[model samples]
Target: MKQSSAKQYAFSDAEYEELRRIIEQSVGIALASGKRDLVYGRVSRRVRALGLSSFAEYLARLRKGDQAELEELVNAMTTNVTQFFRESHHFDYLRETFLPEMVQRHQRDRVIRIWSAGCSSGEEPYSIAVVMAEFLDAHPGWRAEIWATDVDGAILRQAEEGVYPMESLKDVSQERLRRFFLRGKGVNEGKVRVGKSLREIVQFQRVNLIQPWRIRQSFDAVFCRNVIIYFDRAHKKQVVEGFADHLAPKGHLFLGHSESLHGLTDRYQLIGKTIYRRRD
Candidate 1:
């Protein structure tokens, strides 16, 4: 069912400025002028639901710190647009380069720890799991622990279920399709669900990367793709520095293709397409 077009709610100049400040303060994303359409398009539902006619009243309600109001605002601002294997280069690099090097160095443990830091609805992590599962199957003796996390609780819940429409798998390979997913039967035609083996391998949790991440054990790979784009320079630097602190020696950092660590930090060396390695 399509949601009706939201009521036209106008914002005073002061309210608009405050809204911009609130979003930037909370999530570190900068909103410039001409985003008024985006602002109204996103927040109009809030206005309608609250039966409020003005942005000022909505802002006033949010100021009271109503938990639901806060969550709605955050959800409205966050970009949850993601899909399975959206960036194939990162996966290819992982399979061809990163895994080979790790396999050679850590022959004894034969363990792989991968973190999908900004995992949205499980696609990134599930993609990682499928890759690792295939690699391990070919290698004869290896185990992997894949941790998938996001700040949004609602999306995390959807991810835990591991069910998706057929459209979501358009870019996925047939071999991976056969191995990691089950074709829905009965009332589930035209749908696919991740097989238990693949689903069980990924541990999903809610995490805000802006806060101090306390996972003391370092990761062999961290897929924080597309996440840093929303963060301002200082926040990006802080996140990257923190990532360097926790990343294992020689561990890989894979970011969004458009994002860059250039002038941001000297902690990692550029290796492949958008892939960075921890400095030894």
Candidate 2:
């Protein structure tokens, strides 16, 4: 199939296969058969930016082990569609059921840890941070830490920056809007910065879920929402098992609305909508 316009470089089937291989091998995400146009649109820009004339040349450079180009390829292929409070029900559950129980369980230590796996552009972790901050504010002695991670370094930088357009905060309540964000001013008008307190509670890091995870700390809750859909069954199983391994006993795992652990593993029991609890 002709992948791009005549003015732009053509993407051959062989070149697509090579790009697909690199993406799957490096990130455990499988591009479906119909994603040729999408891949071409994202990757062709990279080819042009590097002054390459064709997808064949891009594939050749990749085959010769260009690590930087490989990084760019992964960044280009990875999808990051997220919003603040994307699934409001999950946050409601966290606020009403989970946080109270967690506070009681960790009363002595006064610490709670949550992981936002595949956190894109800081929204998920920031949402978690908002909830945690509300709880901690009410209970003065408690502390909460949120670790947000993703494979794409570029998007992680955006997350670390914690800046977003005003429209992105629409779902966020007026109350939260006033409490958690500072309205941008001057040349920064129409943007919002997450408050210092909320930002302080969340940390962003580059983590490829398919690779070996070096984090040793167990978490009370893990939000890997909407992430595993890109992976095939085997890789999905691997990532879920890894989440189970790192969760504290009876910890909760939240999947995306379209995702599930049915036939994947028995380490967790379904507790709520797209939510699972680690079996004791």
Candidate 3:
């Protein structure tokens, strides 16, 4: 069904379909037809921002290769819904089982690398940093690094700043809140900044998962939770295969609580809740 013709500049089904295709090709997120309203709500601002009259006019500009506008469109379309320690079980498994194994496997190198794909607003990577820091604090004598990437450059900048509202720490314990974050003051009251220790271990990058980027490092664990669920099956396979290529042999891949690889591929084995290890 098409959007109502009653309203001027109604986001028609054809325009929405075109937008969906472009977004999927660009970032692999298969926006649903149900997302028409969402797409319009977010993108109409873009049209108005360009002083354009209609959605058609804005999309025509996109067709003309306005690289900057394309980027902004993607950013606006991308959702950055996240919170600290969101799926707590994953962190539990990481702190208990995965980190120990990583440290043991890399005894000779004394280094561990983890990737936080789709990390938004710094929460996921910062949470991982807390786990890594506590492990290093107890075990000592090792370097652990995390590469956090997202498709949204605007959000990536916010992640790099390492700042968050104090309420985002509800799940964060007092010990961690004190150890890994610095409290804000006066003008900045009600917020906190990720402390130096966690920041030292996390490096931020803007990357489109389906597209190529020059990331030379391999990782022992990849936290791509909740990301691939937006992609179509083929793109999910492509993205997961790409992760497999970059992961160390037998390394772990963590998906969202609701995500799975059952029919996607045979590259991994389900070892725990939402956890898969690359097959040997």
Candidate 4:
């Protein structure tokens, strides 16, 4: 414990508060007081990487408006935990409930659009693509498109590449394994690349949720699960309200199981576990 606490640079309370405020203002991520060590460790890496001698010097650089450093700080501090199907039920709903309703609603025009906000490394969107492929197979001639977006440009590149450890697909069935992935060999063993068909349907882009969105088209569904919990109440409401504004009439919205729309917005009505629909 002593060695752990014996950080190389001195971390002061004032520095911590300043960082917390800067993070919240920049990305809308609310860094709680308990996350001091997390911030210190991540920020310290930046200081060292830049060859700065102290935390004060790093803070001085940040205050002087180093936009590139700011991006690096946020990227280092942000968490990007994901899996092929972290919440199995949401995908189940997409397959069993949402698509059927959408199919009937758009019988005349069969173009389906989906948005996977904060899609870290592309798992959620790839999972959605699998469901979409199956759906289109069942109902022929239907076209679907998905937009996978995240704030971290680094992770966005990973998502665009469509690679993952073979273990990441444990929840996936053998049939899906054959249909949606190409196994790596020799030097690349133990890794898998997402199939060409799945990659074709998704368009990945860098998007910061706190900032204004450039997308003008509405989506049939929005999967933003577990992302907004990092933001404060006001920012949470703002983002949710933005989702409501952009959703199609009675469009489905899927959030993380731990997240809720309660007291945040009244534009949505609960339809399933952590699922909601925008009110007309």
The best candidate by lDDT is: 2
lDDT of 3 by residue, 1-280 (tens): 5775565467877899999999999999999878877888889889888888998899899999998998999899888999999999999999999988887789788889999999978899999999989988877789989999999999999999998999989999999888888999999999999999889899999889989868787899999999999999999999999999899988999999889998989999999999999997
* Residue runs of model 1 more than 4 Å from their true location after superposition: 1-7
- The residue-by-residue lDDT of candidate 2 on 1-280, one tens digit each, is 5455564777777788878888999999999878988888999899999998888888989989998999898999889999999989999999999999998888678899999999989999999999889877889888899999998999999998899999999999999999999999999999999999899999899999999999889999999999999998999999999999999988999999999999999999998999999998
lDDT of 1: 0.85
Cα TM-score of candidate 1: 0.91
- Model 1 agreement with the true structure over 97-124: per-residue lDDT tens digits: 8888889978888888999987988999
CA-lDDT, candidates in order: 0.85, 0.92, 0.91, 0.91
Model 3, TM vs. native: 0.97
Q: How close is candidate 2 to the true structure, as a TM-score?
A: 0.97
Decreasing lDDT order of the candidates: 2, 4, 3, 1
Which is better, 1 or 2, measured by TM-score?
Answer: 2
Candidate 1 displacement at residue 243 in angstroms = 0.9
Cα lDDT tens digits, model 4, 206-227, are 8889999998899999999999
TM-score of each: 0.91, 0.97, 0.97, 0.96
